[model samples]
Target: MSAPLRVLGIESSCDETGIALVECAPAGEPQGVPRLLAHALHSQIEMHQAYGGVVPELASRDHIRRVVPLLRETLAASGLGLEAIDVVAYTRGPGLAGALLVGAGMGCALGLALDRPVLGVHHLEGHLLSPFLSADPPEFPFVALLVSGGHTQLMRVDGVGRYELLGETIDDAAGEAFDKTAKMLGLGYPGGPALSRLAEQGDPAAHALPRPLMKTDNLDFSFAGLKTAVWTRMQRLEAEHGQPIAADGMARPRADLAASTQAAIVDVLLNKSLSALRRTGLKRLVVAGGVGANRRLREQLDEACRRRGVRVHYPELHLCTDNGAMIALAGAMRLQSGQAVAERHYAFDVRPRWDLSAL
Candidate 1:
């Protein structure tokens, strides 16, 4: 019998500070499965919302203040403490430098204090593995489509540390396009959710929006044109209706615009994902990152995959966003796979702009 390995995971790649305690052993149940002990997350979305988007410096400072408390709370919730933490894991890159530093610094410090091993987890990898935390985990060798405010990528995940970049956005990511379009239509900060909510009451055909780069042979995406198209349409509307437009023209009817915008975005994402699946000859698809929580996107993707005879996996809505549990789960997988060991390291560097393929 192998000893149980317990890990403490920390995440601060963006505006969220998450701390989780997870346990894994070499031996699984009869069916073979990993175990999660306890996970805790602290989202600073509301704190940064007044500013329109995440403010890097503020994000870092908030993480610094929250990590310790969250860690303590998570340990308490798990009925354990610093001594039980066998390894300390944290996100290393592909986020704000200041924010990454906060988590990396705290994680390394904890590792040194606890005399435990330290593992650096990639931000995107955490997102990619988030679905594994669900009741039913997907098998390996699946296609992962990570669509977020900062990234839109398609990858073939062979295994941990084995990832192939399939395609990605050439300009604005899907979430970026969402937020920008929402702002253009006078929706406030963090527009994706707000815009999506309004879209529910909207008419899907109220406005025609272009789906950019959909016909291209390559899997690469470009949402910059989509944003531009929204702006152009808005300009035409203004020109036709005079400056500011009539209040009635811009009120709840905005819901229809939101619906049309969301439909266009969903259409592009679904087509691209299906194309990747068809090209890869793989039947399993994993959707991760912030945009993974978009209800419309998930529904459409689910239907499309069903029609195409492919299985789709998604993180629970909470896990869909940034969180520490995913990092812990990813780190535990590493330990179980013999990719990591018990060691202490003080050398920690944060990569603000890292290529997922580089890992």
Candidate 2:
């Protein structure tokens, strides 16, 4: 077998601390499918859930505690060592400052120790490139819908490091809407997943949630209105019931609410994505970020794209959520594209708000 260029990736943008080892060779060469040698993730969801949201200091502390051990485990699982690693990649910006520092510090330290090349990967770029990790990687010059808790944006992705922001949310992101609406419904913290699960049985028709900016010519979105609509509907429901909707009632009405909310979100996302595609004149669409994990969102995008003869690509379910694999894969692609290089100074700082357009 030909020697494969192995890469170690570290991701710690928020509550997730991940480490992965991936190998690369010529795309169609006979070495093997670009393979995942090993991967590990440490989620701070449970810890942060208690606080209803991620506390940056807490997230940073967790990363320091988990990164080293996870790295050890990833290497061992992949049956490789520091010597086998060809490059080190880490997420550099657009995340909690503290958390990004932890990952960046760890990654740079590793690279320096191994005397290997290292690259600073944009968090969104990692998400955009995530689909390439799959066996059926999409060609470049595609449209991208990036939906996460902290961001909602559409982009024209021509290649690695070549991205143009088509549009973005002017207000609350779709994930934020889900979280806020879920809280209004007493869904507790980290409401996006919980709400999605509940939405499975909701009769979307039961509530006529507003599709914000549905008719706007701009690709920009605003979920604040939709979230307000949800709040208003819940208040009306409570007034009608004369008591707070019981947790038990949540089960009976959960599916309908979930379906409706999910539908509204799906509609907005779908409409905006298609609009971006039309404007870019690109038929292929890629959905990334945490919200991309939503089943309904994926199904709707796939179905709609199919009808229009456009294509839609998504990262694997595991990669859809925050993980180190994407960071690693993005780094590998950048290196292969000669777009980035290792740093001589190990004093890289985290950007809590890095713009993709800046790349």
Candidate 3:
């Protein structure tokens, strides 16, 4: 019998450097989900907070410094060494060019050093399969909602590497809308969380906000217009107060605006997701990505799915953000399903704007 394959996964897609080890059981084994042995993640939120956004060059440099240490930490956590790995996988694209290069270079270097094949996993595929890492994972033929930083897409996932695009954002994604609106409120970088924190103190209906594409017949999304609405509201509020917006976010007006913006974004997401589930007649739904960690989105989804007799699955809160576990799991699953082959050729390049549906 062949030994289980140990896959080392590296993720340096944007502002996070993640390393994780996943063990894929031999094909004969009954276990379908790859076992997550150990993982480590380093977030550059603090570093980028000062600039109120990520600086690509700085992000790339930081990934170089952090990737090695994170790999060592992951190995230590897994109680394994370099020789045990059979395959090395790294996020290949749909991210910053420099950041993707850092991870891809390190991963190929490791593969060469260890005489193992290397695989390049898609970033969105990583998120799409992330829920499989959770304690309660969903089965095949499920609807998947991928809501990462700049990407907001709904897909019909039948199995590993079998993804059918359902609908996606026409303009700014949901996460982009959140950040853009939060910026208008003077919330610093990584504004989604900060804005959500303030929204807890305000009412969603305190201010009227437009829900774009709500009446549309199709499942597509449009958050860009909602951002313009938020900007207009902020301008009007500043003029009404004869001053710039407050920084504390405790002011009722700002808090109300934040809540309204969040409600608008979440409303579109929720309605579109439900519409997908109905359209596909799928019983299970999996939501993945950083924005999936929003408390409001989860709460509303739980309630709505329950009423519709639909099952909803999400990656653990910690795993919702980009991480190596998702990337590694994606690689392992693809190989196990015979959908992708690990390459002996280590030379690499990155696609900054690769289309997930193309895969």
TM-score of each candidate structure, all chains considered together:
0.95, 0.94, 0.98
What local distance difference test score does each model get? 0.85, 0.85, 0.92
**Could you say which candidate leads in lDDT?**
3
Query: What are the runs in model 3 whose C-alpha is more than 4 Å off?
Result: 27-31, 247-250
Candidate 2: 10-residue stretch with minimal lDDT:
26-35
Ranking of all predicted structures according to TM-score, beginning with the best and ending with the worst: 3, 1, 2
lDDT of 1: 0.85
Instruction: Please identify which of the two predictions, 2 or 3, would achieve the higher lDDT against the true structure.
Output: 3
Put down candidate 1 lDDT per residue, 1-359, tens digits, no spaces.
65687888899998999999888775242223356778788888789889888899899999999999998889899998688888899998878999999999999998888778798888888888888888778998999999866799999998877889999999999899889888887777788888898889889887888889899899898888878877777777677666552256665557777788889988989999999999999999999988999998999999888988899999888888888998888887866766656457778998888898887
Better of 1 and 3 by TM-score: 3
Cα miss at 279, model 2 (Å)? 2.2
* Candidate 1 Cα errors over 4 Å, as ranges: 26-33, 243-249, 340-342
- Top-scoring candidate (TM-score): 3
Q: Candidate 2 lDDT, tens digit per residue, 138-247?
A: 88889999997868999998887888888899999999988887887777878899989888867778888999997899999899999888777777777766667446
